[model samples]
Target chain A: MIKHDLVIVGGGPAGMAAAVAAYDSGVKDVVIIDRDASLGGILQQCIHNGFGLHKLGEELTGPEYASVYEKKVRERNITIYNDMMVTCLTADKIVTAQGSSGILKIQAKAVILAMGCRERSRGALNICGTRPAGIYSAGTAQKLMNCEGYSVGKKVVILGSGDIGLIMARRMTLEGAKVEAVCEIMPYSGGLTRNIVQCLEDYNIPLYLSHTVAEIHGQKRLEGVTIAQVDENRRIIENTKRFIACDTLLLSVGLIPENELTKEAGIPIDNITNGAIVDENRQTLVPGIFACGNVLQVHDLVDYVSDEAELAGNGAAQYILNGGCKGDSVCTEAGNGVRYVLPQRVNTGTGKDVSLFLRVTKPYGKVRFTVKSSENVLAKAVRIKAAPGEMEKITIKADLLNNITEPITVELEEV
Target chain B: MIKNITCIICPKGCSLTAEINEGIVCVNGNTCERGKQYATDECLNPTRTVTSMVRVSNKCNCMVSVKTVKPIPKGKIFETMELIRGAEVCAPVSIGDVILEDVFGTQVIATKNIDR
Candidate 1:
């Protein structure tokens, strides 16, 4: 078995960032294992710009953003194993992976899980349809068009207004395909506001809000799809049905975090985030194991992924250097309009400020985010607008953590 | 005349009012300098960065992603796309390689390296 001080799984933005940060923090024996032949992961297939505006201070394409870290990993002499799929992970930090060369086993003192997430497939939707060609997940269509040069279809109808779906509307249009409509069951789009402007509005593609695809038509190849507006309870209204003729139906429904490794390692998982339960340091319940990026929670942007992975990477390095963080633990709750909050538990003795990342339950105007312990407000921020489509972050000061007498709760309130 | 514009420079999606009486133009409701510029420019001339995939003959299994080196006039989106449509390139194209030059007054360059 090959031994290393730190082993990072999946070399996407999260894994690459973690490896770089861990190496710079005095842990030199770090190795990254990825299932793709390249280190960029999904970013390799994402060709459009809009990443790195926050972290890198410049707008870059997905591949361009990933290249910045890839250069750092290479310059630091960190080892990387590509085209390798991790098959098993143990409680003791043992990783068994299969690659072109066969089974490879690695025993490590610390492991960082950054496997990211997968797209929700048609099986989850269960829409009435004849199994036909030309159906695709938004990301799959993106990969097919961006990475593997192929036009998915001539006439397209997207069944979700998520970022990928919106982006694909513009992409298909630019590739000379006719994008008829983008339907979303939610009243508000799941995509960022800019995507709605640049991807859908700029092209004049109609976005039907509170609507969804009710039925799909076609046998050998997709011929058309029926769309309908949903009621407040999410059931489709029969009178609102409309048929849109198209050769393709692309679904951009949702994403599920890839946490099979965390599960196999016996780490407790959060049903909400569908990721490993982690603390401020991104350390999982398993002493020497950690989770970051999409494996911790699905983020709307890649810039946040790099930032979160840096924490996990530094946490792993500290674990190797100073054993582990053991102290009084306090639980965090998502209250009011909040959906879920990260750092499920915080260490009171860590002597570091904890950043709480979360999403709101729904869209709101003029709001205040409050982080409080029963009696006192720990932190608060006012915003003009807040929505479930965007993740919001706030930092709880360490001094406030030191004086906290009760479990903290992060809540949103309308101002 | 006055027009309302939503700055797409960032996710803020600031709603800006563009006032142009005569040739002098001014914008309001922008949170940032970039948003202000975007609002004014959008009122004057709208533009967008065009990205799409081009077929590769040799690498029949994969397509090469390309984009205009700079933002093109919004009106020219379809015109530029017409130039991109039915176009094919050979495999072994590297990022930054010019796929189509002077495409609707702008160059279309490969954003990724594809090897068959």
Candidate 2:
């Protein structure tokens, strides 16, 4: 058995960033284990641009953004175990991994979970359809085309207006494939407005809001799809059904954080985010186990993932050097038009500002967000618009957390 | 005429209104100077950085992602894509390696590294 101060699972953007931050914060003995042969993770397959505008102050492709972090990890001379799958993690912080050689066991002082997320597939949607060959997840198709050089399909109909679906619509169009339409079950798009404009509108591909693929048609291969409008409750309207002939169907409904290891270790999970519940430092309920990036909450941008990973890294370093974080944490609640707030808890005694990240239950125009602790209002900020597709962040100063005895609640109010 | 434009410069996605009269553009509702510039350029001539993959011969990883070094005219996106579709490169491609030169006055460079 090998011993290390810190072990990060999944050498994606989060793991690489966490390793770098932990090393900088006085934890020099760090190791990263990734199942993939390379360290970039999903970013390697994500070849498009529109990444790193906030964190790096420049527009970059996904691969470029990942290389920045990969370079950092390499320069620090950190140990990286590539093509190794971590099969088990214990409550006592023992990580068991399997590689080409054999099973390897490591006793780690602290562990950071950064497994990222996976795309929701057709099986989860319950769309009535025969199993066909032309169906592919948007991410899968992206990897196939971007990395493997395979032309997925010629005529495509995309379901779900999530960023991946929107991106694929444009990608298919650019590859000389004819994109029929993009349908979303929700009235408002879950994708960023930039994507809506650049990917769909720019290509003249129509986006059907409050619509979905009612039934997928074809047996041996996808022949077409039945599209229909959905009402407020997302039930298909009978008379609004229409058929569009296409050879391919791409599903980009949602993303769920990949946390089998986190759950296996008995860490508490958040139903709304589908990730592990963590504190402001990104530390999970399990001591010495930290969760960040998509494993904590699915973020719309990679820059935010890097930011959250740094917090987890710093928290892990403190946990190792200072012994452990001991204090009563104030619980955070989501209220009134808010879906959920991350870092479900915050340690007020840390004497540092805490940033609360959240999403609105629905889209709103001209509103204000209020962060309160019982009777005391902690912070307030107004926005011209708020959408479920974008994540909102509010930072509460350290001075305001003094002697707070109540659970903090975040709510949205009309401005 | 007044046009509503969604500023894509950042994720804030500030909604901007541009009024174009006799070649002079005035933009409103933008929170920054960059948004104003974006609105003006959008009103006059719009461009986009075209990113796509090109086939790589003689490698297991058969594709490498590439992009124009600068934004090209939005109208030329399809034409540029057609040009990229027929282009091919060999292995040992590094990031920033020129794949297509003088594509609408901008070079198309590899954005990823592919080993031989």
Candidate 3:
């Protein structure tokens, strides 16, 4: 049995950041375990640039961002186990894994789960289609092209305007593929506006909003697809049916936090985020175990993921050093117009301003987000517009939370 | 005469109007200081985030990861990429590691793990 002050699972951005924070915070014995043969998680396959705008203040491709962190980890002499997949986690923070060598057991004083997330594939969508050779998830196609150097197809139709889809459109175009269109069932795109302009508009790829592929028409390989506009109820408007001949279909529908291990560990998972239910300190209901990154919530940018991971890392270190940060935690609730607030519990005694990250339920014009404790408005921020695609952050000073005995709630109201 | 300018700092793409009276720049419609700076720089020069991967040692299967230490002039991607490609490091990395410390005086850090 191996022992460490902090054992981090996943070894992605979240795990690496958490390990660094924990080490820098004074916990020296840190070990990171990952299933991948190497580190970087999903970033390795993401060759197209666009990441690190907020965190690094410069746009970087996935591998570029990951390399900087990897170098830091090496300089720090942090222990890392590659090709090691953690198979079991006990509530007491004992982790068991199987690697290329043999079985490994680790007893950690504190643990941070940075397993990152998984992309949703065709199986999750239940799309009715012949089990053809050409259907691929956008991410899979990206990996095949960017990392493996295999061109997926000559003609492509992307279903879902998620960032992966948009990025892939540009990638395929650059690879000499004729990208026909990117279709989305939602009225709005799930990707950033810049991606739409740079990846689609610049490439002259059409974006059909509020539309979906009604049927996949092919036998052995993709021959064509039928697309139609959807009404408010998402039912296909029969009259708007159009057929596009294509040899490939890529689904960028969505991403779900890979939480099978969390579930297997018996941790309470949030229905909305598909992550663990954690308080402001990023601690799961299970003591000594914390979660961050896409595993906690699907963040739009990697910068946010790094920030969240740092918080979890520091919090985990505090847990290892101070016996845990679970003071008299107060419940934080979401009020009107707000979709959901993370870090559901806040330990005011920690004496740090808590940043609440949330998304609006829908598009709004002229809205104000208010933080209240039933007695007074602690803080508020106004915006000319808000969208579900964008996340909003509001920081509540430690002093404001110190005096509040009741729960804090954040709400948005149309102004 | 009055001219309208927009803050190109973000995708929100806020429009800021500037009134030029006797060669004095009176700016309005800025949502934040970032917007104010963007409005001022939009006319002089525009900048963009630089992102590119650096080559890690063969220990990591010749993979790379990146971060922009700072923003640079717009359309300087290839120039920035040249610097990134030449920089190399041995692996077993961490978050926020300075891979190419001050690449052209820009602090480009790493954001993901790279196995050495």
Most accurate candidate by DockQ = 2
- Which candidate achieves the best lDDT against the true structure? 2
Candidate 3 docking classification: incorrect
> What clash pairs does model 1 have?
A148-B62, A148-B63, A149-B62, A149-B63
Scored against the true structure, residue A278 in model 2 reaches a CA lDDT of 89
Global fold similarity of model 1 (TM-score): 0.96
Model 1 misplaced regions, further than 4 Å: B55-60, B84-94, B98-106, B114-116
- Model 3 Cα lDDT, one tens digit per residue, B31-89: 77877776555545556555444556656334444656666665554566667667876
Q: What interface RMSD do all candidates show, one decimal each?
A: 1.7, 1.1, 5.0
lDDT of 3 by residue, A1-415 (tens): 9788888999888888888888899988989999998778887887666668677887566876787677778879699899999999888889999988589998989888888777788777766667778989999988776555567999999999998899889778755689998999998888776677657875689999999988888889999888889999888999999999999999999888988778888899988778999988799999889999999998877778889999998989888899777568788888898888897877876678899999888778889999998877878999887877778889988888777778889999899
Residue B83 error, candidate 3, Å: 18
List model 1 lDDT by residue over A123-239, tens digit each. Answer: 999899798898999999999888776779999999888888998898888777999999999898998888998888887899999999999999899999999999998899999
lDDT at A187, model 3 = 89
- Model 2 C-alpha lDDT per residue in residues A191-221, reported as the tens digit of each score: 9998998899888999999999999889899
Off by over 4 Å in 3: B1-116
Model 3: what is its DockQ?
0.16
Q: lDDT of model 1 at residue A88?
A: 97
**Best of the candidates, TM-score:** 2
Superposed Cα deviation of residue A312, candidate 3 (Å): 0.8
